[model samples]
Target: MTGQVSVAGLGPGHEAQITPEVSAALAGATDVLGYIPYVARIAPRPGLVLHASDNREELGRARAALDLAAQGRRVVIVSSGDPGVFAMASALFEAVEATGRTDIDIRILPGITAMLAAAARAGAPLGHDFCAINLSDNLKPAALVEHRLRHAARGDFAMAFYNPRSASRPDGFGRALQILREECGPGRLVVFARAVSTPEERLAITTLAEARPEMADMRTVVLVGNSHTRRVGGWVYAPRSATVSAPASDPEGDA
Candidate 1:
């Protein structure tokens, strides 16, 4: 039997949100590796081996899975959301490149990401042009994050944020709110969707002026509307059509 590696997503939180393709992959996996929380989602079986590691061990985990596959094990690497969207798929590819293992058979299975799930729950805040940004500075610099935030805001694009805040870096999201308020103004809509599709799920809609940093945490996915986003009845949405004057080009050479 040929060794294979399947990097699969398990969806946001609910089992129902997981795609049939990913579930099927999990069922046939001889070995599974992932973050501790994600690996816990898989059921134990007679021939299956589960490897759970800390969240910071992504690169190591990816290499381990590849090694297992090289040994002819049907390995599956699981992530909470879409593997391609801020998850294991990228890490797996990076490991493949570092190890010079181009011959490995790898499959990237997609699932509903937290951003899209939150958008659906909020009545389509991302109905128009949008961009998703991860605010954590663990892998990238903070200056780059603010630069992207300003550009995205200036372009009148709706925005989705993942890993918005944590205890150690609580001040970052507060600074982000300040930047958004300056670029998009006080009246723009902001949605805070936490733990979507789960029992503890929460959805809050407010204007940028009223938004506070304390409203968000690690589990929360923050959404900012373009200038055209508005509320219809009890739901918030960004209209399909928008009419806005073009923003001025950056003075620092960025267009």
Candidate 2:
């Protein structure tokens, strides 16, 4: 209603995937702040303002949105997937709190998260117990990331890895594969989904030892199947129950 800031999730693909609510909010928003690609996803509307920036400026971008809200201007901090899940929502609120600027009312609208989208596209890969982890060490230490990776691998939990690898941090993915091989064994199934849901999307399903860390990039998400993951329709997912084929039909009796 009144001037406020909303953190909107744009999903993993182009504009069509975004919910109607997010689209409306973006239309009404005086300004939208986010990464360049995310901003470009939405068509240019009259009287709408766009503030695109590099990935590292997420915190600053959120702070700007909050400030605009404080001035009675509608703002939206857009992210690729669900705002709260490894997106800009956390930084937006944290900056507002750190600045002691609570005057701006904030709203967060949910959207199709990459992990969930990947699961649906790859079959029921997440039907069972699973966890989401970001492989990038920009916000956290590599040692801490390694510790978490080892624990997840040992627990045999299905894992959806965000920001799996990038040009800048090439070794992160390699280190993860090494740890998973040691803890989950070499034969464990893993799924490599790149630019998922987009035109350039690519998928590779393979075993832990068979998976190549070099296959990942900034726009990729890697799903590490648990002990139960199996191949289905060219993808890998964890099945809830054992598969059973039906008995042969009595064709002669029907005739």
Q: Pick by lDDT: which candidate is best?
A: 1
Task: Provide C-alpha RMSD values for all models, in order.
Answer: 1.7, 9.6
- Residue-pair clash count for candidate 2: 0
Model 2 regions lying over 4 Å from their true place: 241-255
How does each model score on lDDT?
0.92, 0.83
Q: How accurate is candidate 2 locally (lDDT)?
A: 0.83
Candidate 1 residue runs with Cα over 4 Å from true position: 246-255
Question: Looking at model 1, which ten-residue stretch has the lowest summed lDDT?
Answer: 246-255
Predict model 1's lDDT versus the native: 0.92
lDDT of 2 by residue, 1-255 (tens): 347989999998956778999988988888988999898886777888899999899778988887788778889889998998999989987898888887778899898998887777787788877889998899999999998876676556789999998889988889899888877778888777787789998877778888887888888888888777888667666888533222122224454
lDDT of 1 by residue, 1-255 (tens): 458999998999999999999999998999999999899999999999999999989999999988999899999999988999888999999999999988889999999999999999999899999999999999999999999999899888999999999988989999999999888889999999999999999999999999999999999999999988999987999888998645544444573
